[model samples]
Target: MRQYQAVEETGMSINKKIRHIENTIVLSPSFKQAIAMIRECHERSKLTTEPKCMLLIGNTGYGKTTIANHYVGQYARVVSKDGTTVPVFYSMIPSNATIKGLACRLLEDLGDPLYDRGTTINMTSRLCRLIKECKVELIILDEFQHLIDRDSDRVLRSTADWLKDVLNRTKVPIVLMGMPNANSILTVNPQLMRRFANICELKAFNWNPVKERDDFLRFLIMIEKATFFPQPSILHSNEIALRIFCATKGVVSYIKKLISKAAEIAYVKNLDRVTTEALALAYNDELALSNTMSNPFLVDHENLNIPSLEQSFHNSSDAARHGGKRRVAEILRR
Candidate 1:
């Protein structure tokens, strides 16, 4: 019997199967390493001395925030005689964030309802007291890149300095996660850079080189195993692997999105397996890449202009923003 049939025989509902497919976390090697590092930092924070900080840098949709959330979830809050003890606190740095704004956000995350009304000094003091009281071992600042202000050097520098002060006061480890450009925030601030000397980068998969290709293929197999359909998908096939890579550019988020959408399409159409045609439809629906000539899954491999196709994929958002005018221009020129 097919995998989906077996699952259905065991009384698994279609919605449950689809939920499993959507929630699957295929932990790559880098994800495992990052989790380990987070644990190490948490352990180090128990010591009386100041804990070393970590900066996690990655491109958008590269799983930085997901990994952070995963690690923090592992150390969820515990109740003690004093109050609720949150081992790890997670907060997102708001866009155009200032020192006071960040302090208020952190306070709010720690359960201070009136955090928004306090002065910077009052908020900082209250935050430090709450951290100690709640026994927060680690602080994870997601979208740390937002702390940087391109227009105001003073605000940027002050924000970094404020972070340094928070670390000094709390004596807890902090993990800063954001896109690659966030690294510039550290480079410009010597003190902050020195404090967060340890950095971990989560990078997208690459197609070139034999090992990377093999790893990518293995990842495809993992995805296939995780997905449930009436019949097995040929995602592990060599041709499909190339097509998937071309469509997603080896980004894990994009790969998951493509597979999930394809599975949904198969279910809706009463298709037995996820086919190249289904993938093309998913790409069109999810990513808005409708040009059959540019779609790797729809075209002959030898005729595929990979560089041009990648450029088009990158520009897909811009094309949508401008109402596909640029996309039409490119197609007509071609």
Candidate 2:
């Protein structure tokens, strides 16, 4: 009975920590800039006769979708012809996205019927009419990387051209979200590429020695508070924190998982605080998991040290010129 109680307590404590860490999520500086740029473009697009499009390119787990979600919630708005306002429609391109599937998804978001006979053209026309009717300021398409994943490249190209025509007709800002290869897909379609003038690229987490230490401490504080079972205590080990930065390579997604996994292991072992021994076991487990699955995004560093800001921000000079707009152009040009 006592053993069971201990296990129960540990489980409860671990769950709390996980929840706390999730709730106290932090956006890196680059991500914050991207969100701000998107918000600004959405606002400007609503005021202008021409649509202002933005293409968000980033790596997986780098908060590309999260930033888009935030902008959709905060900035995206539908303006009525008579000046009434409401939230704009948001949709994501599916894993097995086809021209038909993407059209259906957009129509569904606009509360239109998803019946048969709506070819990519029909659906695009319908969507443009809806956008005009609803005065949708922005059409945010997440997972736009799926554009290249259509059954055939021809279908994908057709979808791209159709999307460009819709935008040309509706004059509504379009935000495309995807990972690295998304640029290649967009560039292949000249019309689509023209609409996507503003490119916001996001890199994985860059550990700012100046800011990371504080961020690391704050993260540990949240972890401590979250670990309720076995009595919460602070992590006094700097070495553990260093290992964390190394394991995650400062990428927020991987970092979140590693920390959460460490807490989980500590809970299972009935440890109050995450000890180095427990951490080592967690590392081995994570490494094993990574071998079986492509999970972690750590970089090659001596003893797993985080990369310097210089390495992370190699494109800083280029990014500063257009304040990020040119960054997308750079990618498209490449």
Candidate 3:
């Protein structure tokens, strides 16, 4: 009975730490900049007849969604004399996003019960009308890269044209958030290219000694403060911080995971604080890094295993960017 109680307590304690990290987003410098830029776009959107569009591009787990949520929180939906006034309208591009699916998604966000019931044109008219009726100042669409996944040129062009028509009809400033390759959707259609003049990006932290390192450490410190388990987190310490950077490649989500995993290990074992051993074990479990030598927490790092800023930002397909296919070929041959 006592053993079962101890196990339950351990699970509960670790779960609290994980939940704390998951629920709270500790804003990084890039995250703050993205927010500022979005605010600027919102302000600029209000004053002009020709609405300015912003393309917010980032890799997975870079906190682009968090920025969008933050903006939406600031200008909440309100009941007014006329009707509901939604300063910001936010939705995601639907999976297998066709023209009709896109319209239905927008209609659904605008509170239409039978969103899926309308034809493409019917839903488009409804969306435009709601934007005007609700006095919506900005429209934010996330996961826009869904339009590109496994699509042919003809379908891509059709979807792009549909988006252009929406922009023309609504005349509301829009923020399109997607993965880095999402720019391809714009490049395919020059009309969209012209609409989206302002571009913002959220990126992982780099291993620069002067500015970036301090920024990363500060961000980690903030996250550590938020975790409910204990204090004096060793994650912000110099050596551990560098190892974390190497492990996560400075990606915000990966960093949070590593810290949370380490916290779990510490909590379950009744340790007071996170340790390198806990971190090492977490590193092995969380990441798919097959190279044992590259395990930052376990191995003594001679140098940071981070890619250059230029290399990280290079535009390429995922398959092209990763060379793991060669290893697969070798394994098959054996």
Candidate 4:
């Protein structure tokens, strides 16, 4: 029997299966490691005089947010007659965020009634008080890269200093996460960097058989187990696997997108199973790369120009530099 299989043979309504696909999280090894590291920092902060901070850097679409959310869920808050105890607090750093703006956001998440009405110092004080009052052991701030100057990519010194003060006050483990460029935020702030000196980098999944293929296959199987697929184990087959790898370039979010869309197509059309054509339609509809020779599902593997795995990461700057649809297209054409 397949692992974690739900009902047998289309037990769910077509819509439910499609919905389940979006919820399915395949916990690959790297994902588990990153979560473990974050948990350790959370636990460590409990005993330290100084707060422990960690920086998690990964490419876009690599599931950093998912990890943050999963970590929060794992250590969910408890409520009782004594009071509500929030073990973990998660918030996203807004684009062009000010220290006051950021503090208000955190305060809002912590249930402060007047989230937007305080001065910068007042809000930070209230935010820190709430963090301690609620007994929050960990604070997770996502989108850390937005802390840098977009033009120069330099860390915003004033905001960085403000964040350092919050950690000093709260004395709770804090996880800062963003795309790989977020490292630029740290490089410019030595003090802040030292505070979060222990860093974890999550790289994209590689397709080379010698290094990462087995893990990728296992990931697909795990996704299979999480849902009642019309057919099973078809994703890990060599042919479909190759198509998936080429289509998604081993990015977790893209893989999920392809699978979810293909499953949606299969169910809507009453297909016996997810087929290359379904994946082709899914890829075209969702990825916006259809009709071009680059669509992995539409072309012969031999004919498709798969870019170097290292070049697979998509970013705005890279896209602008390379021009057109994206760098992947440029890489494929070479």
Candidate 5:
């Protein structure tokens, strides 16, 4: 096969091959828009007295963190006479994060070695000083929903107030990213909600509207270009596209995982290209899909049941609640 010949000629190692496949990042339409929005907000924050904050909400594995990381990379740390200046700072909210814990995490990200030793007040004071010292213009908090406890109203209000206090003191734009439930933290605090007036939602792809389907196919082509197979795989074909959509429920992350696994399996088996059998095997092996469900790739397009496919999607979402591995297993069981 062409791919096999190319691999042999180059003598590429398996580790390098896997890294090449894993490192591909497609700049989809939504991702591009998010980058633009972040830049605009960052620029506006520099000139305005009031911070222009944004809430970025989406399902898990919907590229929310990836977009934030991309934006941060654009303004990586700059060396100057004074010290290192980080234009964009990023941190993750610890699960059930408290005001003190949040403060310590921010301090740690700011390069403070003694962050964990400080009390809440001491940490907040140091955090404010470091923010100015480091010249940080924007802060991104991923998994921001963890700031509030669902069971305690007192904890929720205190944490929300702490965030507002930080914004008032720093006047730096903050982007909070997390699952859709992250909105609840804002809904409970009107002042905080009003401050973060600019809200962005990252949605998964759907087969509706011819354009969406066409765009997904284009995305597949992009993925195929990055993926190294023994031979060319017609991933953009209508049959494969429909089957992939059914299997992944239009989630880009899931699609990437499925393709990567299938590619790896094809490479190991010395196959010319990924076939329906390889895809089915990948689905079972990587996703732990239950044998009870029909394999999308193996079934006829016309015979595919919409309700059953949707149930698979629902199961995937439900499984996400528990964790990644469990979620996959749960979906297959359904």
Candidate 6:
């Protein structure tokens, strides 16, 4: 008789290198527009009198960073229609930054340091001069939401005004990346809003069957295949994928972690394919606050202490139907 590896006991290995990039979704038209504009700014750096500025707004894990990275990569190599060359410099705005600190970061990115000794105003003047001299065109400020923590609204308003002033003085494009809430912040400040005349919002993945599913799944499978190097594994069926979608609610970061954990379980059991059993086991094993793996009353597989995991398929199926919402509520209330 052949022996079956207990689903509860499986251990799967995962490729960490691949997991890092799994969170990035394919670029949509909105994302492409941001890329196009950023490139235009870089390509027109030497010629344009007025600088271009864009503000990118999005929820977490919505590929804001990835899109920004992609923009930098493309713009760094921009070539003119007549085969002329342009240099694109990239700089990150430091978290919890003041105007002087931001100027320092920009100076550092340009391979120099502001040596002028005086108040913040003096430093700002020196930095502006350097930016003009260097002909820097594009400035990307990531995590710009931190500026809101200023104790005085005046400070915040001044920061916004100063940034607007810098852009006008330098004639350089600026891209601000931050959480969704940052959009409201920018809208409230007239100066900031004017600078961000062209706004782009990045949203989470939408599994609309018409256009996204193909690229989305390919992106997913690519991560899975690359993460589990040497020994490739396939999902037992689409059902497993659906379960994953339901469990993670399409959060790319959580999806990778759940799948990686499942693969680790499968690897431990020496299984070549990831089974529903392994997936369930992995789901149950996840200790994060967001996990919807197994219902509280549903019981775990025979060996696990989760009573709900031990419940019969009929009850488990019912739990799956109600989505274990009641059970989860009960657990939370406790």
lDDT digits (tens) for residues 20-112 of candidate 2: 766655655576789777877788887888888888888888887777777667744544556534345578887656667777877777767
Clashes, model 5 = 2
Best by TM-score: 5
State the lDDT of candidate 1 residue by residue for 57-124, as single tens digits: 99989999899889877887887667889888999998878888888888888888798977898889
TM-scores of all predicted structures: 0.85, 0.71, 0.83, 0.86, 0.87, 0.67
Candidate 1 TM-score, C-alpha based: 0.85
The lDDT of model 1 is 0.78
lDDT of 5 by residue, 1-334 (tens): 6656655553666567667767787888888888888888899988988989998989988999889988888888887888879889999988788899889889888888898986898888888888988999999989987876756733367877898999888888999899888788888889999999998899887654567777788888888877666467888786677778777777888888888888777776667677778888887776545335577777655445344334555575553465444533332333
Off by over 4 Å in 1: 1-14, 79-81, 150-155, 289-293, 308-334
Write down the lDDT of every candidate, Cα atoms only: 0.78, 0.64, 0.77, 0.78, 0.78, 0.59
- Estimate the TM-score for candidate 5: 0.87
Q: If both were scored by lDDT, which would come out higher, candidate 1 or candidate 2?
A: 1
List ranges where model 5 is wrong by over 4 Å: 1-3, 79-81, 150-155, 290-292, 305-334
Of models 3 and 6, which has the larger lDDT? 3
The segments of candidate 3 whose C-alpha lies over 4 angstroms from its true place after superposition are 1-14, 79-83, 149-155, 228-231, 289-293, 303-334
Q: In angstroms, how far off is 154's CA in candidate 6?
A: 8.9
Q: How does candidate 2 fare on TM-score? A: 0.71
- Pick out the ten consecutive residues of candidate 4 with the lowest summed lDDT: 1-10
Question: After best superposition, candidate 4 residue 2: deviation in angstroms?
Answer: 23
